[model samples]
Target: MQLLPDSWPPARRWVQVALINLVVAALLGALMRYIFLWEVPGVEYRNIMHAHSHGAMLGWVYLVLFTGYVLLAGPARRVYTYLFWATQLTVVAIFVLFALQGYSASSIAATSLHVLLSYVAVALLWPDLRRRLAGTVALPYLLAGLGSIVLSTLGLWALGIIMSSKPPNMTLFYLAIQFFLHGQLNGWFMFGTLGLVVAYFEKQQLPLNRPRLRQAFILLLCSLLPTYGLAVAWAERHPAIYAVTALGVLLQLLGVVQWLRAVWPALQQLTARLAPLLRGLWAFGIGSLAFKALVHAAVAVPYVAVMSFTVRNFVIGFVHLVTLGATTLTLLALLHGQGLLSLRGRVARLGAWLLLAGFVLTEMLLFLQGLMLWLDWSFIPSYHTVLLLATLLLPAGALLLALRAARAPASTDPGAQPLPQYAAHSPVSANGSADTAANR
Candidate 1:
């Protein structure tokens, strides 16, 4: 019910547009997957893929962050809306131009414009968000997320510089992409969204192990920069970088363990109160974090490191795990918890389930293919068809979500009953005591 946005033409449109963008991105992805069977005139594979990824990142993820911030934290300065539109325009331009020409002058200009807009976005939004720093763990993570945005620009600039030269250092180009990817995926989207989730708990006065929460935060925050080495390890065979990556892996594992121990119980209790759809979303999202930490640990190994990056299927599968499973679902849960989506609403629930199912299937296909390649097994027959079909559900879900989101009532029913509040000092079941303590 009117949870996010206080902007012109209704804040709800922001959400609707964002979801619509998601639908478009998913469609683009599906098209790419299916292109093998159906050739589209004048379409380039890499160009469309660029649109797919950039659309998801900038159109969906970036816009959703803005929606959540305004929804949960309340209104900020006037410049917020202006920056929001400008950024959206740039994203659209890049997506369209890239489809026309891969890394051409037009797309590059649009990309540079986006990078500039991103800087302004962080600058305008950061001060307003500092209040989020007062007590909850969310603020610091958000700050780090914004910092990642800026740091990513350095990579962007570096890549631009090299691309202009007679012969670009391909390794350097990849390093630039790595910096941007790791930061955007891990730093900005993951941390920022997770922080908001914690803030919601704090707001609800939910039980948590506050000390462990702090530990997890510290461990993860401290590990963030060093973890860049994992991305760097992709290009560099330097022993020192690998060693640093190993350390980052350990820290990440510790952080994740601390986080799970601290919040898992509270989360369980909370999910018990949530609707089935919400629970599924939570399962997809939070569970991905646990699995991702384990995967990161494994990937950190010296033997596995090269394969993780070198294998195209592995790379695609891994990226989707983060984007669809972890980032998108977690943010969706946040939206539902913020009262943006109806837990019992048929359209929303159906859309969420479809998205989850699609993600699962897509990952399955990609990983299966990767495994085949790794073991020297025969390729999966009609692999392209399988991926294409799996990927289609993503957009299908997004379309339903966007349609219903657009039709969503401005607010929840006036007669709707509110769930009983769980006061900070309230007693939970014996099982939850440890978790409640984490909130202290």
Candidate 2:
């Protein structure tokens, strides 16, 4: 399991490049917040915001998941290398074009290409991953993820039609976003991470309840389609839709709890092996997920659904809660699990802590703002400056992480490794510390 460059391990290069994307996206996000505070602008806010969101979603998240896939199935697949670089090209093109002019001719073309490339990724991955992953219990989760990705494309197509039409359907635009986000958060991100977690447990010869995990997966899949009604409820204003969506939200919550229970024992085992910062990531990431499910289900009430969409603070806070709190942290944990991030040394430790601090502070500010709005405070003073400064921590941490990766030695080692792949299966004590053999 030693790193070798001649072999061109996809884990090293792809993840390195992905971390750069993460830093860039964070910088773009910070810049957006900066303008909101100071209004210093050469570039348009909306256009740059487009770049920020697209870069964060496609550039960082998609690329990281692609790296995780390669890690799980093995890096010997050639199509993966092709998909990796090709998608990077698309991401760069979209980000540049969007920053210059939001959804202008070039940006529109790039967006179209991004959608096509996603399908291309799935097409290239399915045959190869399915083959190598055969007979593995986690294979279904992986394949379901790919399928969800392709299914999510329907939203992009819907968006394109709406945009191209003379009078764009504004309602459909939001609906499309909901479609993409729901499928992605629950389908691609959750399933992919779950598969990797299961694979890690398998490597450790840990016991898992496959039936329970699969039941969770199935419930999520069933609930996803109806959950779109939760978003659509804003426009439709139908009580029946609210009822159905409430049921879907409840099901999603139940499914997650089921999956979490199945993983709890393994997570306790894995937690003791992780660095403290990484352990914090697992705690916050999974904790936010439970919070999200509860909040999302709360929208089963018709008035709450409208408020969630209409209130700027609530909207932004929830979106960041999903992207940064749930997806980003989970992705970081999986990346570390896959051995791409060393997660040792002061540099890595500092970077992780800074990112966590940034996230917590930003969340606090956002939640406070939302509280102000809910309580009829009209607005919160100095909110913009506080948010802008808080946002800076994200990029600062991301940059340090990239630097730490750059400074790390070419090959990883045995005893000095972070979360060694085959650490002894000794039991963990009640205090969450590993026993002697596992620690050594």
Candidate 3:
């Protein structure tokens, strides 16, 4: 919509750009896998890795979150438009600079600038959101998500200090990195997505078990800080750390149980009306989150913790379980639910299937390799080639998604109809236009 300045892209463009960014990041990942199978000249593994991780984190996830906030929060201020573009510029800079120079000064500065931009966004938007969402289910999780974002920066600062030290304390350096990663991925990303889900339920007037929801929220919130111990236990394996991590893991597992109890009834009813693809995505996303909790619980075991951290494959597999399985899948479902993603299009449906298949295959390969290593078995034959082939599906899927989003007109599917509640509460219309009266 022309909700922003004429020079800026519309709200729909924000979503398309975010999807395109995912395509680019996935392509970079495919390239990395390719390099593993056969050495590619002038392509540095570590440097390209920096590009892929940062791009996926900031470009796809963060931007989508930003878009969700802006779209759902109603008519945004001009400042938000400025902030969005500024953040996007910095994300691009980080990807490019990191690809070329790893963590050189330019890349570092760009990364730091993106963080600062987020702070500025939070400062401007948080109070308004709090007031608007007061007494609502989404408020607490959104507040905690923002708070976690700030808290994670402490780890980044600590990391800088650790790295700058003469003959840097390598242990603390890794610990600091884990601290930041845990907070950002587990705290901010997971919590923020939960908040968005609750907000969606509210907007759609879906049934919810409030008491169970509150119980889940409390347990999950309480576990967030202590769970940092679980992330760092690999670096420091004291009994005290394990004890705290065990408690966190237990709390988190209970939280997941409560969460499922609270939402599954409504979710079952909701998905029943959706197309097959959308329905599958919803189930897959929620199921992945539940599985993630189980994975975290397993890490509480001393032997499992030791093996998980010792094996790089395990670490990567776990990260993907969170990022691609839980976070990305849920985000895609949300987008489709909101009419931001057009599954009626053949290309989009094909893309969704391909992406899901790729994620499943690659995850199997990764954890299977980790299991073989844990059991003192030989490597899988042609692991690199098979993994590369699987990885290629991800970029191909993402590329198709991006292309479909770019070419298809926004929400133009005549066969698609929103639920009654959506028409009543939705802030924007189907044609990339904000509803001034409805938003107000």
lDDT of 1 by residue, 117-224 (tens): 888777766776675346665677667777878876687788889898878989889888888888788778777777777767665556778888888878887777
Per-residue C-alpha lDDT of model 3 across residues 1-440, encoded as one tens digit per residue:
22222222355577788888899899999999989878999989999998998899889988888776665454346887888889999989988999999977789889889999989877875886776677777778777777888888788789778878999998898888788788888888888888887777765657888888889999998888888886678777899998898889889999989988988877877787777777777777788889888988887787887887889898888888888888888888877666566667889889998898899899999999999999999999999999999988998988888877733334445223221121124344444456443431
Per-residue lDDT over 159-186 for candidate 2, one digit per residue giving the tens place of the 0 to 100 score = 8888888888888888887788777776
Best-matching candidate per TM-score = 3
Clashes of each: 10, 0, 0
User: How many times do residue backbones clash in model 2?
Assistant: 0
Measured by TM-score, how close is model 3 to the native structure?
A: 0.92
TM-score of each: 0.89, 0.89, 0.92
| Candidate 2, superposed: residue stretches over 4 Å from native | 1-6, 378-381, 406-440
Ranked candidates (TM-score, high to low)? 3, 2, 1
Clash list (residue pairs), candidate 1: 4-71, 208-435, 208-436, 208-438, 208-439, 209-437, 209-438, 209-439, 210-438, 210-439
Preferred candidate (lDDT higher): 1 or 3 = 3
Candidate 3 lDDT for residue 346: 88
Candidate 3: regions farther than 4 A off:
1-9, 406-428, 431-440
Pairs that clash in candidate 2: none
Candidate 3: residue 377 Cα off by (Å): 1.3
lDDT of each: 0.74, 0.74, 0.79
Error of 1 at 34 (Å): 0.5
